[model samples]
Target: MIRVRGTVGAWPVDLQIELDDQDWAALARQASAEPATTAAAAARPSGDDPLWSRAQALLREAGELEGPELLAALAALAGSDQAGKRLLVRLRHCDQVEIVQRGEAPLYRWIAQ
Candidate 1:
């Protein structure tokens, strides 16, 4: 399980994803295949940047998102760095997901099972 915590707008959200070793390895392989263009690389947050830290937190929480849904989530979050809002929208559109939350706050945790 990977645990991630960060803010979406004024609210804070936490994300967690459970993956076996094989799944993790597969993701690494896929990421490694992508072309590492300088402009594309620059778009991502640096380790020292606060936004990058937040993005990492969100990614950790997101776990094993794949396909178009994953692309949409990344686009939305990358556009505004609002993971919680982007997640809520994605969950509403996806048919194979389970979302859990504490009360009415924007904070939520989801699994794509």
Candidate 2:
């Protein structure tokens, strides 16, 4: 059984699929046929990813922005709050980003490399 729960374009999605033995075998076969490099490349995020590139570009263009404000923009771009939050977390840990506490809020600044 495969369960997927997430949002797609502002819509919440919850799905479950139960696969039989044959289906599982077929899936395993397809996965094993793929090149190891392809799987590894897909798992790692890169500038080639559109959402990641755009998220970085948005922060770069802003120079600096408050956490909530930047999160709202990212949420809009990502089409869901959860997705936006994921991007925000990534930005918080990014080498090019500097985070500072201002009162109760966080300020995210893009440091040019």
Candidate 3:
């Protein structure tokens, strides 16, 4: 099962899609068939200024947000999990942000202007 929460045409959407074992296996096989180098080449950031600017804006606007929500939003903005993770790592090193343990998930808090 996969849960998706986002906006579609200015309307907020939250939904879940469930896949059978066969479907899961097919997805796994398809992922494994992809070449690592191809994925790596695609993962490389191209002029990251826009992405970073948007990221900082999101951090400032959110003030404080749960980790999973932040990840999902970042992934949505970035268009890929790899890119989202990269953004999260970059945010982690920023002086204006802080991530702290909060129960099972971390919380992202903006600490500077």
Candidate 1 yields a Cα-based lDDT of 0.57
Please estimate how well model 3 matches the true structure, expressed as its whole-model Cα lDDT.
0.88
lDDT of each: 0.57, 0.94, 0.88
The stretch of ten residues in a row with the least summed lDDT in candidate 3 is 40-49
Q: How close to the true structure is residue 85 of candidate 2, measured as C-alpha lDDT?
A: 98
After superposition, candidate 3 runs with Cα above 4 Å error: 1-48
lDDT of 2 by residue, 32-104 (tens): 9998899999877776779988999999999999999999999999999999999999999899999999998
Question: Is candidate 1 or 2 superior in TM-score?
Answer: 2
- The alpha-carbon deviation from the true structure for residue 45 of candidate 2, after best TM-score superposition, in angstroms, is 2.2
Angstrom error at residue 11, model 1: 1.8
Ranking under TM-score, best-scoring first?
Answer: 2, 3, 1
After superposition on all C-alphas, the RMSD of every candidate to the true structure, in Å, is 18.3, 7.7, 12.1
Name the top lDDT candidate: 2
- How many residue-pair clashes does candidate 1 contain? 1
> Taking the tens digit of each residue's C-alpha lDDT, what string does model 3 give over 1-113?
99999999999999999999999999999899988888998876555689988987898898987888888888889999988888888888788998899799998999996
